[model samples]
Target: MSIIIITGGSRGIGASAAKQCAAKGMGIILTYNSHPAGAESVVRQINAVGGKAVALALDVTKVRSFAAFRDDVAKALKSTWGKDHIDGLVNNAGYGNFNAIEAVSEAEFDGLLNVHLKGPFFLTQALLPLMAAGGHIINMTSATTRVATPGAAPYAAFKGGLEVLTRYMAKEFGPRKIRANAISPGAIRTDMTSKAFDQSPEFVTLLAGQTALGKIGEADDVGRVIASLLSEDNGWVNAQTIEVGGGYNI
Candidate 1:
């Protein structure tokens, strides 16, 4: 059985992707940071639907814990699926913080860096040995990296860094037949964007205007794309950053 690990699989795009991938008959090892109940609920839903899934707790910012996490993943694979290797890794765990560059404190910057870039980097490295040949890596980035958004300078910057890292990962890991790609999502109606949308109708209108598709995105909109990229049909697609926005700011 082909198994995949998805970080932050408890809610939003992560949860949607987990369900979609399971529907395609893939075994899932999903991780959550603060929402065990949410993660368990997702697992229950998947299993109830005749899919296989397991949820594990993980803090993406804690790079030091990656080795232990990898061990846990290996054990889960062995016990649950009778496998020692996984076919894909989705680095999707992240938090959004809005702050202008001048107002961004050192701690805020560090936190974003740790989760967005540093954690994914080391986590992939730690798990590489156990990743099967032809395995794929999907990094979750943001459309902010493409079109600059005010009050999100640091967050956008780090996401941009992850985009560059995606290409480098594809380059270095090519010999192993491992492909790396990034999914850059536009404004989605997840918890992350609820406040912004609720606070200002004008803001919502502005975002919708920027999108050629004439609306904000839903979590499933982006999730399905991520799942598709991980499938064998997209096996030749590599080192690309596919934007999942509704043609935002285009």
Candidate 2:
């Protein structure tokens, strides 16, 4: 069976992606930062359905720890799937921050940069050795990169950088027959945005109005796409940034 590692799989889109990928008969090694319970819950759910999954702790922002994290992944592969290499990776761990550029603090900007850009770069580099030939890498980005959302300047900037990095990864890893692509989601209702949706109904309505489909997305909307891309169904798709928004800002 194909084995895949998804970071930030404890909750939100990452959690959904883990379940979806498992449903497709892939062995999952999902990582969580601060939420081991959430990750374990996902693993249990997958196991309950006769799918195999394992949860490990990972803090993506800590580039220094990626080597150790890679070791843990190697161990997981061996113990859980009896495999030495992973078929795919999903760089999906991140947090949301909303602040105007003029008011954004240096710490805030650096935090976003570390998690969204630096983390993916080094983590991918660290895990490259364990990636099997013909493997795929999926970077989870955001539609804010395309739409220029006002309060998401730093976040969008880093995600845009990740999109560019995706192309570069495809170019560099082509010799290994590895594919790289990005999923750009728009206004997905996850734990990350639940507070905004609850506290400000107008915010939700405004986003819905901006979308051609007249509604924001659910986690499954993007999760299923990620699973399909990881599968052989999208073997020819590479170096692309697929916007999973329902035609927002078009």
How would you encode candidate 2's per-residue C-alpha lDDT over 21-78 as one tens digit per residue? 9999999999998999999999999999999999999888888899999999998888
TM-score of each: 0.98, 0.99
Name the Cα RMSD for model 1.
0.8
Q: Which one is best on TM-score?
A: 2
Q: How do the residues 144-228 of candidate 1 rate in per-residue lDDT, one tens digit apiece?
A: 9989899989899999999999999999999999999999999888867787789998988889988999999999998899889
RMSD of each: 0.8, 0.6
Best by lDDT: 2
Q: Which stretches of candidate 1 lie over 4 Å from their true place?
A: none
Return the TM-score for candidate 2, rounded to 2 decimals.
0.99
Clashes of 2: 0
Model 1 residue pairs with clashes: none
